[model samples]
Target: MPETPSALPPPSPSSSLPGLRFAFGTLTVLPVRVTRWDRPAARAGMLCAPLVGVVAGGAAGLLGAVLLLLGAGPLLAAVGAAAVPALLTRGLHLDGLADTADGLGSGKPADDALRIMKQSDIGPFGVLTLVLVLLAQVAALAEAYDGSWAQGVLAAVVSGASARLAMTLAARRGTPAARPEGLGAAVAQTVPVAGALALAALLTALAALAGGALLGTYGAVRAAAAVVVAVATAQSLLRRCVRRFGGVTGDVFGALAETAATAALVVLALG
Candidate 1:
């Protein structure tokens, strides 16, 4: 018999790079303790989110620029930017969207509907939800593209940051996880509202400084819209989760972030 291959070593922990660990720990894994803003660890993690947004947004923006440069048209650029983020996050939100759709579509009791959501297999309702959400996103992006690289980059960054902010807010509100334990629970309990607000304010100011009043206003509005949608959606989902599964889960939180982000972008484009 062939020998089993050795597993890769876990990532090293570094005090100097607490932000990376916080981001990775809160977003990607289930840790016993999520760093708190009052503590240095939570502050470090808070920084990680915006940094990730900037890097991811920049890359997506560059791809959009390339598509435009190649004469691919605004629609293509929109699609590419949207697709890049989805791929980067490995469709985490999309999966949540799908699950939520399936749960909601069943018309069954809350418990039964949630059980359906927990199933790994996608249902017909999930497929329809995915299609509609993607269509809405593509349409919004195509309309927003104005043949300007700066706008594209700003749009990407704002969308990403706003979405992450939504997630942070949801966690702060005590949305429970469906499973007994996970990163979502830890994040919800650990991240501070003040830090999130501060980050949003700083990012808004930076956008205004970099892009002028109109651009800054747009970013601010987008962020606000994202927060509203996130909060409302989280409340609705949390209630449903409580009725069914007795609490919220990491997946629902991811779904809330994606939905809010997409809605915020659409609203910004329309404005």
Candidate 2:
């Protein structure tokens, strides 16, 4: 008898969600269709970053509120607030942050650095980076916790939005991923300047609504600074990637996002 052809596997769940598609487009080390967004799509995606931020922030705020209601100490509340975003993103940034630390610290050739990052095991650099990142995040949360719950929520929103904006900047400035098809391509094709500006405005408005002049100014400054840092860092990474592997990768983008978010929150807290 003639054999029937094998059935194709079902499409992965990631193929369904726009956000997940975008995330995969931005973070995966493979090639992807980076050219879906026209100006509107770009704006939509950029704006979506803050929307995700708002959702994540609201969750963090709720977590903090519940913890407080349950008689958990301020420290725990702060930690929970920080952990919520990390958890929501499934520690994507944390992994990026860790890989970045290991890659950059190794001082090996770019290929070696990328290889180290791809390794499943965490290195000394990864551990140290995680500690520093968590420490900074915890301190920021602790400070934000002193204010009203609104302030905590605002902090979470600003941090999340600013990180995406930072990623946009990186996408613009950094080299494409080696594969020519993954997140790097999609982001480079889709993310636009106008959308980033709109996100900034939205973040500013949200901060004003949440805490008036003080928080508004602080959030704006923090976000702007984070963007600058993220762009610069991403450029540096891009250069390294090109020199080593001929292009950027998902890991690099993730690292940039996490670094930018952490810096934004810390600055907002300090401010």
Candidate 3:
């Protein structure tokens, strides 16, 4: 017999707490204690991912602004901005990016590729990809900071939020998991496509508003474009990874986030 609606358990004391805890717990080295690991919590966490990015990126941007105030050059400030997210996440995303690169670059069979990604060591492809991606991020951030400290900060926040937005969309329903276990399996296909789209629209609007307030009309256009282009780039990678790996993995998510961040920064760097 099916359980009636009233037979369901009472809602948590704070309905949002579980999601918040899950987001911070998994995405960052935050102190939040995750009270749930089920699909509901994962759904809410993925939906809230952009906010997590905003906070992490906000910290990164603030650090860059602080360095600037201390008379550091734009390059140094940019480096600081790039490093904070890594520290906050315990470099998990970077490691994932490296592993994903190795896996995809090997051109081996799907099973072999998955095994490569599972290993702890980084390959030459991973090293090269990491170097190029990091260089691109730092150079773009340096250019933005040189333009203005506000622009630099905006770049960091926008890219951070957009990066996680990519991850959120990657978790939308119908997306498959490459493995039957691990983080990807736990969170994959947890987000509704409509929900993901709505979140994206909301974030894009906020970016436009904030950009206009900070950098004027041109800034608004660039900010919106950055989000759009970043999403497009991430989706491109998503399609390719699905073809190569047969589905999504935790490493693929990391690659998407990094790619989105780098794309956003590059767009913001444009004259």
Name the candidate that leads on lDDT.
3
Q: How many clashes in each candidate?
A: 5, 9, 0
Question: Which digits, one per residue and each the tens of the lDDT, describe model 1 over residues 1-271?
Answer: 2111122122235432765556655554334244432234543564466565555556676788788889888889989988876776778778887887787778888678767877999999889878887887777666666637666766676666656655655554344455545544444434455655676667655544544543566555654554455345545655665566555666676676567567656765665
- The most accurate candidate by TM-score is 3
Q: What lDDT does the true structure give each of the candidates?
A: 0.62, 0.60, 0.90
- RMSD values for the candidates in order, in angstroms, are 8.2, 8.5, 3.4
Give the runs in model 1 whose Cα sits over 4 Å from its true position: 1-16, 24-47, 107-111, 204-245
Q: TM-score for candidate 2, please give it.
A: 0.72
Return the TM-score for each candidate structure: 0.74, 0.72, 0.95
Q: Report the CA-based lDDT of candidate 3 relative to the real structure.
A: 0.90
RMSD of candidate 2 to the truth, in angstroms, is 8.5
TM-score of 1: 0.74
Best of the two (1, 3) by lDDT: 3
lDDT of 3 by residue, 126-214 (tens): 99999999999999999989988899999999999999999999998778889988888878887778889999999999999989999
**Model 3: CA > 4 A from native:** 1-15
